[model samples]
Target: MAEKKIDKARRNFLFGAVRRFKNEDPDQIEASTAECVDLIKQANALYVDGDFEAARDAYRDCLKSDQNDADIRYRLGVCQYRVGKYRQAKLEFERTLRIDRTYQDAFLYLGLTLVRLGKPEKAPALWSQYFNIKAVVVQRELNLQIGLLENGESDPADTIAEAVEKAIEQAGSAVG
Candidate 1:
């Protein structure tokens, strides 16, 4: 009877410990997420303050914490670019795109990086791809807006086709 009581006590203790850990797991995860967001905000502030090296270091730290974050990789590449590290920036941008194939800004920056690396001819293809992606996204957004207007959820303004033409013109100017 004593042995049975002891065994039951041990089991109860173990179960209570496990329950406590399970309850705390979400708090730990939330703290980690908050820390990561703080790091990103700090890195962006450093970049905006013209401290490219510091921004790069912070971004590197963030990458160490989350290597799969394509946005951080892209920002790190921009910092590298601002610091005149074209080769490293190019690699970083490439990595960003590898992580997120639909990242349009990475495509633009990669094209610019190629231009800086004296490979102007290579930029055209990237630019073309960037424009194509932009066109698709813009078309999708315009279609949504048009649908909203048709359903009376949005006020009717200019036609969707006109908006698309204007967006294309803007995109062309931006590319040139």
Candidate 2:
């Protein structure tokens, strides 16, 4: 009974906030969303320009308005990654994939996040999924690694495919 009351209170508070937001001028809201998008774009550009903190702030503001936007979420994750916020980036990537399972970029970035988190086995699966969904660059990178292994340029167990699969298993706690 207490739990239900708490839930009801939470819902009421949320609905009140939404109502207040809705009561604002539509033009202002549209402008804000657009500005948020622009901020995200600017953040990406700034990241490319090597300004990580500014990018992070811009992405955060963008997310405040459109939290479910997968692209923005992924970009925010990437910015977090660039700033060495691996855990936060991992969460953002996970959220992005949850919002859009077919989001190849999110999968790829998730793999990269796992790598940063030092769980190598999981990284490879994400890399593989990314290869399958958007195969050109990732596939080429994997194939190149395979070729290197064939030539004995790298350890067999550390071949990109094996490495990725192992990373997945390790991340899943299947490995010690």
Candidate 3:
């Protein structure tokens, strides 16, 4: 009889919780999402305008609402970097990459942050990965240009080979 009473109470509590959840206003949820989007947009504008401190604050506000947003974390890191908070920026960037490993920009910034933190030796491997991805993108663009040229399109001022060579030079300079 005690077991039956406990089970009944447990089921009643769950049903009550579900009923309360289902009773939430859809408009409230939509408003919350829209507010988050607006905050992110405002933060991005502030960052672009070079107001790093303000942008960082706005990003923090957004993060309060959505802790798992990797892009927000990355932008916050960038703001921290601009403000000379290298150690904090490093942590944020690392967190961003942890949340989204395919975030190439975070990797590049994290490496740059390491360099600024006086750990230059650790940056090369990160930069190498960044440059490899860059090279692949450049190669794709070069192939498109070559294809256009082969089909009798006007030759661009700089050939695909020249672009590839320049990318290699820049990569070398970045590493060395």
Candidate 4:
């Protein structure tokens, strides 16, 4: 009897909360969302003013609600890079790319981060990848032959096809 009473109370409390939310005005919700936009504007202003630490903190606060925002993530990475926190910057850049692979600026910043970490040799590939994204963007209008792999699907290698098939067969592979 006590457990049943507790469950009823919990259900009533949740329903009351939902009803209160449903009664709130849509404009109120939009204004709340816009607070994050305002924060982003403030962060950009701070960054432009060379106050990277403040900008970084503001960006992080915005990210708490919109964790998947690539632009904000990229800006945070730039702030970290400016503050000489190469590792954190690298992580932010990597996360930005993981969220949106077409983000070219992340590639550029990631390369710079690598160079700062004393891995100059690895930076070229990052730069090339950045250019590849640019090439793809520009190629559509310019009609230029900028070789960019737009998709993961590719024609099977002719030379290794049979050998690879045989090896797979030997290993009892079920790959189609």
Candidate 5:
């Protein structure tokens, strides 16, 4: 009888939590949106002013309000990366990617973090993803470097044109 009662209570609690989450008020979302926008602006201003520490704090506050925001998470990761918190930066970037799989910048930065960690082999997929999203010339240059590192090739720029051609083909496939 005791075990049955305990099981019933657990089920009830779980149901209640799910109900609350499912019925979360629209007003909460609106309020959080306003707060997040303001916080993002402040954080950006701080970053532009070279106040990275303050920017980090502002980004953290934004995350507290809307933990699921991929852009905010990505900005926070960049700030953390600039501050030399590589592991925390990686975690934030990973979380951003989890929220939005198509976030190219997070993948690029995550690849950078992996490179810093001496895991060069793990960077090609992320670099490829970034390339597929945007055709920035700088990113193209970086991709060749990462590809060279992964393949243990000493000449990074040897096949630059060929790699860019392939990357463009891949990017076309992505849009299709």
Candidate 6:
């Protein structure tokens, strides 16, 4: 008799929780959206100003609000890369990719981070993944920039065509 009473109470509690979850406060969601916009604006300003540490902190704050956002995770990874936190950057990029496998930039950045960590062999796979997701024209432009050393893996927004080139060269030598 006592066991049946406990089961009934547990079922009722679960149903109540589900009901509350399905009826979230709309105004609260609106306020969170506005706050997220403000945080993004602040983080973007800090990033554009070349204050990566501050931008990283701001991005982290944004993550607290939306932990599953792949773009925020990618931005945090870029900021970590800029600050020479290669391992942290690598982890963030990995997390970003896990959240959104089709995020081409995360693949590129993860490849670059691998090269920076002296794990060049891992980069080719990631670069290949990036190429698979990227457009041919964009790939050509990025390769051109990297060949010229203009954008060659310099920043998060930049290209990692050099890593791809190096990986190809390494493969050629191994085959030879």
Q: lDDT tens digits, residues 1-176, model 4?
A: 11111233344455665757778533332112344767887888897787999999999998886677788889899899889898999999999999999887687668667756765455556656654322333223112111221232222223222332243234331211
TM-score of each: 0.57, 0.59, 0.58, 0.57, 0.67, 0.61
Per-residue C-alpha lDDT of model 3 across residues 1-176, encoded as one tens digit per residue: 11121233344455665657789533342113334777777888898787999999999998886666788899899899879898999999999988988777676667667756765456546655553444555434434444554465624333433453355446542311
| Clash-forming residue pairs, model 5 | none
Q: What's the CA RMSD of model 6 in angstroms?
A: 13.8
Instruction: Name the regions of candidate 2 deviating beyond 4 angstroms.
Output: 1-32, 132-137, 143-176
Residue by residue across 1-176, what tens digits does model 5's lDDT show? 11111233344455665658788643332222553565678787887676878999998997776677787788788788778787998999999999999887787778777765656567677777774435555466666676576678824332443454345445542311
**Best-first order by TM-score:** 5, 6, 2, 3, 1, 4
Worst 10 residues of 4 by lDDT: 141-150
| lDDT minimum window of 10 residues, candidate 2 | 1-10
TM-score of candidate 2 versus the correct structure, residues matched by position: 0.59
Model with the higher lDDT, candidate 2 or 5: 5
Predicted candidate 6 versus true structure: per-residue lDDT over 1-176, tens digit per residue: 11111233344455665657888543343113334767777887887677999999999997876677787889889889879999999999999989999888788778778867866545656666666322444455335434444334443322343544444334432210
What's the C-alpha lDDT at position 68 in model 3?
64
What is the Å distance of residue 170 in model 5 from its true position? Answer: 24
List model 1 lDDT by residue over 58-86, tens digit each: 99987765676788899899889878898
Q: Between the candidate structures 5 and 6, which one is better when assessed by TM-score?
A: 5
Candidate 6 accuracy as TM-score: 0.61
Which pairs of residues collide in candidate 4? none
- Among all candidates shown, the one with the greatest lDDT: 5
In order of listing, the candidates' clash counts read: 0, 7, 0, 0, 0, 0
Model 3 residue-pair collision total: 0
lDDT of 4: 0.62
Q: After aligning candidate 4 to the native by TM-score, how far in Å is the CA of 107 from where it should be?
A: 0.6
RMSD of 5: 11.9
Candidate 3 colliding pairs: none
Q: What Cα-based lDDT does every candidate model obtain?
A: 0.65, 0.62, 0.65, 0.62, 0.67, 0.65
Model 3 root mean square deviation, Cα atoms: 15.3
